[model samples]
Target chain A: MDTIIQGKAYVLGKNIDTDQIIPAEHLVYSLSDPEEVKLYGKYALSGVPPEQGGLPQGNIPFVTEGTFHSDYTIIVAGPNFGCGSSREHAPFALQVAGAKAIVAESYARIFYRNCVDGGFVIPYETSVPLTGVIKTGDELKIDIEANTVTNLETNITFTLNPLGDVFSIVRAGGIFAYARQENLMAQS
Target chain B: MAQTITQKILSRAANRKFVDTGENVWLNVDILLTHDVCGPPTFDIFKQEFGPDAKVWDPEKVVVLPDHYIFTANEHAHRNIDLLRQFASEQSLPNYYDVGTDRYKGVCHVALAEEGFNIPGTVLFGTDSHTCTSGAFGMFGSGIGNTDAAFILGTGKLWEKVPESMKFIFEGDMPEYLCAKDLILQILGDIGTDGATYRAMEFDGEAVYSLPVDERMTLCNMAIEAGGMNGIIAADAVTEAYVKAHSSKPYEIFQSDPDADYHSVYRYNVRELEPVVAKPHSPDNRATVRSMQGTKITKSYIGSCTGGKLTDFMLAAKILKGKQVTVPTNIVPATVLVARALECETWEGVTLKKIFEDAGCSIALPSCAACLGGPADTVGRSADQDVVVSTTNRNFPGRMGSKKAEVYLASPLTAAASAVTGKLTDPREFL
Candidate 1:
């Protein structure tokens, strides 16, 4: 069940607050709709949602929904992602939406773990240059099995940590499927 | 080898006689505390990562409260509180304080000490950075992420980087208008937020000894802005009495050796220090509030975990007994205990809330309402309407909700004066 996401890598700027993660309005009753949560970056995609959401949204968010990397599971951001509040919901919404891994310059200590503890999402660190090297609509091919990221534009490839054996199964879906597979193998 | 409190805790956690730089240590957390904003997230992760029957190490060692969003601005936040309550119900947690529920009240910092949930000489961690406030109780406490916090809940242990020590020896006498809030704000303005990154500040010396436990707590409470593991004032008789009064647990005293290695040492002669402010976008940018005098202020906030102490109210109340706030001001106690303490003994001869109320100042609950920008508090509406004044900690840009609206860092007294006059006014004038 190893997976890799490669496409134009869209860069969401740094310090994206939790309210911007899923927005207080989209939250339906008590249930968090991850499908809709994915729309959080919409303002960034066009620099319109924040203005559309009220405040004059600036170009800083760097939203690129229709751009090449918009569909990629990997998002590279600046330092201190999930900086404000101790909200696990931010990462929950991120993973539940479509992100498989988040590569940031750095992460807020609390939010980073909430992401990992929630599921097997890789949060790696790299130089800030990676943001410019990545372009919207540029397809990045990542091999979940090999733990490598390849830039189609530069033909450069980088290796990342394996999702760990325990997470390899959980990343396939949830713990139920993971435990089911482990149990079936044991029976076999 | 002489043992300091920090060294003792590190050695005990590392299972060694001494610790070296860059050493990995496993330490048992003395207490695990969290607030509403942090509590639910950790619970969700605990449920998924550890399973339902997961055993929380010591229910009695755990303290959880609702502070960040106590009233729940909307339905979603309410559901989040419900989840935390459900988790608490199942775990039989010893110290669970729901908002406005019994005496389990106010800022997380005050509540933890009030219920005797925290003991000196033990290591504690919470989901909030101000958890360092507990270090004033003479124990090592720091803030960590939900991930690390999750492991603490499921495993009761955490791996820590042995923090280097920064010693601050405060000597000399306090001049007329100085207090703990002013001292720490000056420290922040001097060092900036990154000054103590990953280090532990040890407050010692004559002035530190003279400081009451409550004032010392204020010092450690604001240490989070220094970006350190925790700020600790080694235990003395003052600490012992506080611990014995608050908890029945046996206590031990820990101190550092005179020859103990240090990353750095600082000496402050506060006799010459003035009320200072670190301007916006940086907590280290220092300037005297007097220099920024006459700076127009729109909204003034005088309470949060850091600024909201009894001495805080008393100091401001003494000056405000016959005065009024210049602009609309909000003087809030960090917790209900602080509010209640203010009501005790017409101290300096006047109750704080009553004085504030008479002055047309609104004294609110013991919540972190405006500090965290938790609704009803934002600095500016497009730079055109931004307000500026000094507050308790670092003023990183947009830290208080408006990137353009400037935030100035200062002591509670400076803030109180500004609130009264609606402009950046010095406390010296009020006195």
Candidate 2:
């Protein structure tokens, strides 16, 4: 895993739930089916606001086309981010959308665990609130080893708490790979 | 060292004599539950990571129920169930409950209790947030993501962090008009949504123990709304009687030590509480029904794992016996057993269904019908510009349907009285 990650930030508000991350309507796809799985990436963050259809009062859209490429790779949000539902698709959607890491003031437990278990994205817990400090389209450098996030645009830096075993899991590319490396699962 | 109920349960599951807060340990999961919405993705991951030829650790330990969107005829919805059935058959699973069949149970949380899978002192994981409902049985129940669930399917074990415990003591006698829903809503209102984040909310004291198992389930079901890891009540005669009636599985009960460490403690005198409602867009934005009296409602809903139990239906029926509903009301039983009980249950020589139907209310089949807002064709979903007073747990924007629609979360009694008046009327008015 890269100890230092530099990417553009995507800013979101408080209490963004799994439903809003990837609505239940788009959960019909199966990973085993190639055709169905392709829809997941396309529908990623499709519920974000200003995008027509679904949910009358839409939320602020971080990724306009629901696809994250070179720009807008890190998500910075307020408290209780990813609050509803136990859908791993929330993280999978963000991972497929190219979110390298998420720096939030606080997170709902299930969403936090999903990100770590799936190794889809790195969840950074910020001791200081990042909502006001970080802005959309800002270049950021996240150092996992130092637990520090620095704004490359300005020289401001925020401290984050190490996620204990989560660092190892992300380094190994998810729980499945970690388990296999430790011989926790039977050999195929 | 003294241990709380959560500590004891996790210790036992981890096969350790003791475990402390913030410590991560691998636990042997006794039961893993999944539904249509989450099961397919979980199964997909299980197959992909474990390889196509890999078998489940124990088929009997895994329970699959196609509940959430099964009632709808949408092709995608059907495809979800089809995939679950295909996977269950491939694994030769024993506990697969198919919809449109007699074995079909309703919501996975309710079924987990009714089927005896919620044994005390064991760890249970489900793909839905309300899986904490099983904690009412004195078990350690929490929700997990598809990846973690897939790991459990292959290894029958998953990692967990021991959380600090928050003890909530409900003292004094509960008033006749109040139920578990009001008590929990009151707590949520006071604590705010994230007050109990990453902690276990342990319910106790005279009032909590006096509640029936089903009512206790309602209290634990909404713990997730407060951002709690789980909500648990120690096993007592009430819990034992319910578990014995439904399951013959061997189980053990655990309790917190008197010196158990608690992050915080809260007390509530049930006698002073009233029927409260969580207003539009947030479960913690609460107000007493008396204060919000006459707030117009376009529809009324009495269902979901939180409020769609036999006790909830019975309470609503008592208020709607002879009254006609002024708004469109939908009554959904949480489980097949609850639906059957409603059919056979009578008040004033009329079945509960008859009373609801006579009051101009419609009853739907036993599933999570419109609680999560299934397909657009779902029976009771709220439309644009609609204001609904419902007994469902969440009132988040676009939770029931249409982000423009407003939802007021309430108890069944409050819901019934609101339906009769087409406004948020206090149940005490009808009583």
Best prediction by TM-score: 2
lDDT by residue (B156-244, candidate 1, tens digit) is 77667677888888888776677787777777766755567667878888888788877888889877666667889888888788778
At residue B70, candidate 2 shows an lDDT of: 71
Off by over 4 Å in 1: A1-188, B1-4, B14-16, B376-384, B388-404
Q: Provide DockQ values for all models, in the order shown.
A: 0.17, 0.54
Docking quality category of candidate 1 according to DockQ thresholds: incorrect
Candidate 2's DockQ: 0.54
lDDT of 1 by residue, A33-70 (tens): 44434454342223113332211223433434453223
Angstrom error of the Cα, residue B290, model 2: value is 1.6
TM-score of each: 0.81, 0.96
- Worst 10-residue lDDT window for candidate 2 chain A reads A51-60
Tell me, by DockQ, which candidate is best.
Answer: 2
Interface RMSD, prediction 2: 2.2
lDDT of 2 at B79: 90
Question: Model 2, stretches more than 4 Å misplaced?
Answer: A46-60, A65-71, A186-188
